[model samples]
Target chain A: MMQKRTIEIGVGVFVAAGIAALVMLAMKVSNLAAFTNQQGYEVTARFDNIGGLKERSAVTVAGVRIGRVKSIVFDDKDYEAVVTMNIESQHDRLPADTSASILTAGLLGEQYVALEPGGDEAFLKPGGDIKLTQSAIILEKMVGQFLFDKAAGGDGKKEEGAAP
Target chain B: MMGWLQRLGSTSLSVFERLGRGNLFLLRILAALPSLVLRPGLVIAQLYSVGVLSMTLIVISGLNVGMVLGLQGYNTLVDFGSEESLGQLVALSLVRELGPVVAALLFAGRAGSALTAEIGLMKATEQLSGMEMMAVDPLKRVVAPRFIAGIISMPLLAAMFSAVGVLGGFFVGVGLLGVDSGAFWSQMQSKVDLYDDILNGVIKSIVFGCVAAWIAVFEGYDAVPNTEGVSRATTRTVVHTAFAVLGLDFILTALMFGDE
Candidate 1:
């Protein structure tokens, strides 16, 4: 009987430990639990190319995350990516004329929205859109353009030399 | 040459025969699983012995492994000037691969060997035969509970392993090495995905548990009724479980993360 009680207690502890581990895992991996009830205001921004910018990516002001990308949708009429950001209440003092740019952490890492505040007395409302926005830079496209320019310049120089 | 061919054929045939028998034994244990609810005491006892007893080693090894990852990862990432990502590296490695695989290996070594030995000893002493004589189904009464207990305990043990490993990484990265504590945690939270990394790991551990428990119980049930036979069966249980766990881990990883 004593052994039976001890075994029961052991099983209980084992189960509790399992639950605790699972809770910790969910928190550590998802990161959603922490901000589920966060008081925030949503703002929109338009960009030509969002690239690999994912929802839930951080929105940073001066390298500190103040919010997250709430959702993303494509504006078919304007042919642009419409990104919605949920800024925490504490960061509600962002100016109306602030510019948002998609920036990558490290060289080839996750993309986030970096906000640069402007010197404006007006503050951004909950549904206000940030008109000044910069899209993600595609490395391959940039490299291709650089090579094309170099080849084009070399061809012109060679043709001038041949004519002379 | 004909004699050699005959020997090879016979050996292959025997191997297939053993495999078939092992499958049948596993089927019997699984078929008796429904009856386990009626014998909760038996299952609980097995759970205590298998799961609870194995916790200490799992936690200790998990912490040590995490610390090693933290130290190594910090050194490497510091070279790249991205030591802030130490938590991400440690958490991803532990949750995705080492946590499940290492915990399962340890389980096989600690609890699996003990299970095989216990059941094999019971067979050698004719306890199984006696149970049969008493009209009790030895597989249902003895083996089913243990199999279920192992299956249930495996995922829990693996989760515990990962949690402790993360804590260990935290200690080495933040407390000892002067890494910014907030970056260590926030980086991990932002990088690791629940469905991709953590859930997949839990699935791996669960599958490993099933394989290890199946091998252990089957080996014991099929052991020859002698001291030597019992010892050999226990050894085979450890060897077979290790191979099965490792092989299954590769296949699962491919299926889970292959596209990425």
Candidate 2:
């Protein structure tokens, strides 16, 4: 009977743990979703190569994550990568001519979209597309460009190869 | 040189034997599935063992881990003149990687070995064989309940760990560090998404639970004769489960975060 009681106690502890965990998880899910929706307003950007960009990837300005990529679609009519981004509504004044570059964090880190706002007074409206987009810099292409730029320049150092 | 070669060969043979033993452990997991399904009470008991009792430890450890992350992250970000983004970094790092993996490792260390030791001692006593003689399947009675319990408990532990950890980060970054709570929360909410953080954490928990249980049950069943043998099996279960959990975490993280 004592042994039976031990088993019951053990089982009770286990069930209680499961209940506690479930409650915590449900709360987190609801809270996190609400938090994400607080400042995000949708905008679209076009990229020639979206490479490793996925839904929910970070969107940064000057290395600060101000938004996230909400969805990625391919436009058959233009044969371009159409990336829908959700910028925090608080950061609403990005200029119309802003250039979005597809960037990677490191040699093997996750990818993000980096926006470089242009010197223009006209701000992009929600759902408006940012026209200037830089494609992902393929590793092989960057390496090749490095070698090419080196060979083509003692003089070619005058113009730097494009920023990855 | 010849003597050294002989030593190498002997070590290699022992390693292969252990590998073979681990394979046999896989067989035990497969065998336990049916019994686990039929015996719901046992499953519940297992869950209680692995999950509920583990809460205090996970919470305490989780909070410390988060506090450390905030302190370290803030120092680095401040050096770079971007200290305001500390909340984003802390939230992303904890949710994306650290919280689930660390909690699972702790569980494997604490609970996995206990399961293995209990089973191994039972095997050493020949009671396991006694059950066999009575036409009872030990896998159904023992292994199934453990596997079921592990699967159920790990996610719950992970959830507690992540939530507690996040709160810890909040205290350090905003209250102690003097960062604005509103901006900190804003950065976290704007940058981190629900699905990316939660689904990944749950997936890691499930995988860790299965692997940890497998190690414990396998080592226990294959324990050699005598008390010393059972002791060795218990230790091996703890060490192997911890290693496998870490290894699998790397694989899962790579797949989830790779490319796009």
Candidate 3:
């Protein structure tokens, strides 16, 4: 058996180590900083279709994350998806005419909103609507379009040959 | 046939009786908790035994588990050309499932069994009766401190296990396997949510801690006063804790991560 003082010191060290581990987990493993940063402005952009564009998806400028999609609500009046974005205050200088397009990170990855700045002196304010917005490119729709074009091209060649 | 029927009935009655007694024991522990506040030294001593003593096992196992995950994750993900996601894979799996479950299992084996044996031996040697005779209340003096120690140490140990495990994964993934260190960390940071993953894991560990401590103390207190009884109680502690932890883990995972 050890001395009482030694046991006490050992316990104190053990507790401190455990707390340090939790802190390390928060800082190194999880995006705790991003989750707690609430001092940001909200902006809305309407898309015709938002495929897999979920809430909290990254809103990036030139592939750099500057904001996140705060919420996604359907505009029943305009029949479009109204996406609310929370942009960091540091990124408040985005051009009024900046175009927003939904983009994928990789060949098959999460969808995010990408901003392309236009030549406009005015900056987009909080709650302002972005008029130039491109909807997400649905993979199924693209595949169907490609098959339809191929069949039409093949038929066109057959028709030309028969006419000749 | 009559004797067999009587035996089955008696067994069922004993099972219910045991459950009732366990509940009563837990209530008594709760009642005796205030005594711990008065004598913090007792709890501290138990903490040294339960938490500090188990540190080596937890840290080593954590590293081993993480390295294995990194190697296996890299192998499977390399074919898909998504090896960069190895950090995310390791972090998510560790935080969400393996860390708490495995750590709790180890704690039950290392500390739970020991607690049961110690208390059982004390009972077998009539230490508890001695305390009772002196009006010291063994529940407040002996059992409460050990129970409190197990609860306090469980979550901390699990967190340590995960933190060390992540470092192990980093070593194998970036240090040896030539993965881009920036991508490894950045991917993990971007994907893991604090509330969804870390907080959920903490909740699981806390619950597991309570389950393990409760079973250990109860088994010890209820053990028959003999050498064989003490041995049997210790064995039962490990076995029962394993079943409870694994079963509760499945239920918790389904509750927390089912929709996600």
Candidate 4:
């Protein structure tokens, strides 16, 4: 009888410990747990290119996180990327003329949306759009442009001087 | 040449026969599961033996593995000047793959071998036959509880491993290596998803649990009813669990993480 009681107590403790671990994982180790309980409003932003921006990526205002990118869909009509962002209710005072840009965190890190708020009498409302947007910069395109300009200048100028 | 052909054919036949037998045993255990509810004590006791006893091994291994991951990830990411992402690296890898896979393997080694040996010894000593003589179904009384305990234990063990592992990584990264504590935890939280990473890991552990427990109990129940047979069954349990866990991990990973 006494041994059975001991076994039960041990099993109880084991189960409790396991459950506590799961709770910690959910609370401390994942993002959804933080945002799921809070109220948020969705707003759309359009970009020429999204680069590596993914759903659930951070949306930050002045380097402080305010919300998450809720969804991304291709705008067939405009030939652009339509991004839906979920901004926390606490950050509702963002100005109407806010600009949304896709920016990489480090040199080669995950892409996120950065919101640059413009001073306006009106504030951004739910379902409102951010008008000013900058697309993600492609490094290869910049490098190719630099090389092309240098090549054309080097050949055309050098040949003119030599022939003269 | 003829003798070799005969031997190969017999071996193939026996392999099929064993597979069929294992399936039948699993079915019997499933059928007996409903009755297990009437007697909770059996499962609770088995839980102590199977789950509680294995806790020490799981916790220690999880801590050490996390520490190693933290150190290795820090060293590698430091070269790129991205040591702050160490938390994300540790959490993602541990939650997605290492936690479930390692915990299941250790389970097979600790609880699985013990289960097989315990049941096999009973068979060898004629306790199983003796129970049958008394009109008791050994499958119901002996096998089902152990199987239930094993299946229940694995996911919990894996979760604990992941949680503890994250802390272990914190110890190495923020404490020793001087990674920013805020960046360490914040990056991990933002990058890892509850549904995608943690819940999927739980699902993986559950599947691994079913496979490991099924093989362990099946081997024990089907032992040759001799001293040598019992020992062989114990060995087979560990080897089979390892292969099944690793192979299934690949298939599950492709299915789960493939889209991402």
Candidate 5:
């Protein structure tokens, strides 16, 4: 009887713990899910590379996650990644000419789209496209570019123009 | 000189032998998977023991690791006059490398050894043989449940570790360290990507789970002639598994981050 009681208690504890873990998972998923139906000013941004950028990636302005990527589609004709993001309704005053930059989380981390609100007084409407967008700057390419530039212009000294 | 050469040769052969044994054992477990899965009661019980009971330690250790990381990273960054980057450094370190590996190591040390010893004792008592004679497959009855439990438990532990670690970092970095709370949170949000860190964590957990379960179950199953043998096997299991976990961490980190 004691053994049976212990076993019952153990099973109960395990079930409760598993339920708790599921609850936590549910909470986090729900938080992320809330972004799905959030009312926001929709804007499109085009990029040459959406490296590691997912559909639900955050759209941040000044490091605040005010929106999320709604969709990402390849523009076959333009050869660009067209990303549709939904800015929060509260921050709907972002100008039509705002620029977006694809930014890395850290040195070798995932990427997110960052929007820099423009100075224009004309507030961007829903379903508008951000005119300017910067693609992810490939780290290897940047390193290569740096080396080339350094070798070409040695010691930060300007050389006489010899090329015709 | 002869003795030294003999020792070296013996050690090399032993390493190969151990690897061969581990591989064979792994194949045995894989072969027994179907029957193991069919035993839901055993699987559920093992899950409770391995995963549910393991949460406390995972959380406590995780928090300390994160707190220490934040405190130390903050101090170092302050020395370099880049204190603003402390949050980024803390988050990156916790997520990318430290969280999953360290948590797994601790789990192996605690639960992994316990598992080996428990099963080893049972084997030593002839209970395993008794079950075998009673038409029960020990692999399915004994090993499979623990294996599945380990796999399921590891990820849950890792998730708890990551969450606690981040919270700990936040507490130390902002509340105790007196950095601007706004800047700290902003840096975390901007500089931490869920894809890289979280995904790596899940992958590592799965790998670690399999390795830990293999070590424990294998040690128990292969324990030799007597009580002392079982004890020795338990000790060896813990030590070997810990080293293996660290070694695998290095390999996994290299594979995961080599291109990046």
Candidate 6:
């Protein structure tokens, strides 16, 4: 009976440890526990094209992540991507004229919102909008435009050669 | 001229007959499952033998696989100048695929085969029959606890396997290979989502546990009362468990990640 009791306790301990490890792994992998319950205020930014910007993407100021993109919605009236950002309350003293841009990390990495603070005495409130916004740079569109210009130049050169 | 066709027809019929019988056995075990709550001691003993005993094997294999992933992932990512993504690659692969599948395979080989052999021996020795004759249902008294223990143990074991494997990856990536520790962990944290990757893997392990335990118990109960029959049943348990796990994995992956 003593041996059986010992075995039972051992099994119980083993199972508890397994569960604890699972919870830790989930917390570490998801990164939800880091910022989900953080006290923050929301601010809106409107962009012509949000590109691949996703909800939960980091919102960084001067290379430090202050919060995340809370949501991305399309405003039918303005035909723009209206992104809601939740910035930490600790960083709430940003100037009203701060500019927000959709920026990519590394060269081909994930997209984030980069904020550039401007010189202003007044601060933006929770519901305030950041009017100055830069949309994500679409690499494919830029490449296509470059190719089109090259093709047009080549055609003009052919026409000049024919005239000569 | 018709011999080959007759042989094929009979073989297919026998396969269906065996499948039907297996389902019936599973139903019987399910019926007996409620009796387990009354026999907590029996369940605990079985859990010890099946789950706790198997931990050493699961941990060792998990660690080794993680180390290999770190080494291979590092080598591959370095080519693309993305060695920083090594943690993400290792964690994602292990959590999504390797941890559950490999741990289930090992469980089937270790605890699963043992269950078959032990149950087979009891049947061959007429112990199950003796209990049946005494008005105790062998399915409840003998089979149900073991089955419940197996089903309970599997997900926990798989979780342990994944956790240990990640630690192993950290050791290899940071300690041995000189990879940035911060990059390895932070990248993994950012990339692996809770719902999309980790929870789905846990669900897979639960299904695998049910399938493997079901196969092990049924194979043992159905084995003929002889040495040769017991050995044959044990072999079939391992082979069928592997095939079922792999086939189910493919179906689950397609269902979970497939584009609508």
Best by lDDT: 4
Q: What's the TM-score of each model vs. the native?
A: 0.85, 0.69, 0.97, 0.95, 0.69, 0.93
* lDDT (10s digit) by residue, model 1, range B71-161: 9999999998888899999999998899899999999999998999999999999999999999999999999999999999999999999
Off by over 4 Å in 6: A144-164
Q: Could you arrange the candidates by TM-score from highest to lowest? A: 3, 4, 6, 1, 5, 2
Question: Could you give candidate 4's per-residue lDDT for residues B179-203 as a string of tens digits?
Answer: 9999999889988989999999999
Classified by CAPRI criteria, candidate 3 counts as high
Expressed as tens digits, the lDDT of each residue in A1-164 for candidate 1 is 88889999999999899879978988865565656757899999999998889988989999998998999999899999999999998888999999999999888678999999999999999989999999998889999999999999999999999996
Q: Share of real contacts kept by model 2?
A: 0.31
lDDT of 4 by residue, A1-164 (tens): 89888899999999999999999999999986676745799999999999999987889999998998999999899999999999998888999999999999888889999999898979999999999999988878888999999999999999999996
For A1-164, candidate 5 gives per-residue lDDT tens digits of: 67655655775665565445434433331233453558867888889998789887888999988888889999999999999998788887787788999998776556889999888989788888788888888888899999999988874454554433
lDDT of 6 by residue, B1-260 (tens): 59999999999998898899999998999999998888888888999989999999999999999999999999998888888898899898988899889999999999999999999999999999999899999999889998998888888888889988898989999999988999999999988888888898899999999999999998898899899999999999999999999999999999887752
Model 3: TM-score for chain B: 0.98
List native contact recovery per candidate, as a fraction of 1. 0.65, 0.31, 0.94, 0.95, 0.06, 0.58
Question: Can you rank all candidates by DockQ, best first?
Answer: 3, 4, 6, 1, 2, 5
Error at B221, model 1, angstroms? 0.7
The local lDDT score (0 to 100) that residue B14 gets in candidate 4 is 99
RMSD of 3: 1.4
The numbered model that scores best in DockQ is 3
Against the true structure, candidate 1 reaches a TM-score of 0.85
CA deviation > 4 Å runs, candidate 4: A149-164
lDDT of each: 0.91, 0.79, 0.94, 0.95, 0.77, 0.91
Query: What's the C-alpha lDDT at position B26 in model 3?
Result: 97
Output the worst ten-in-a-row residue range by lDDT, candidate 6 chain B.
B251-260
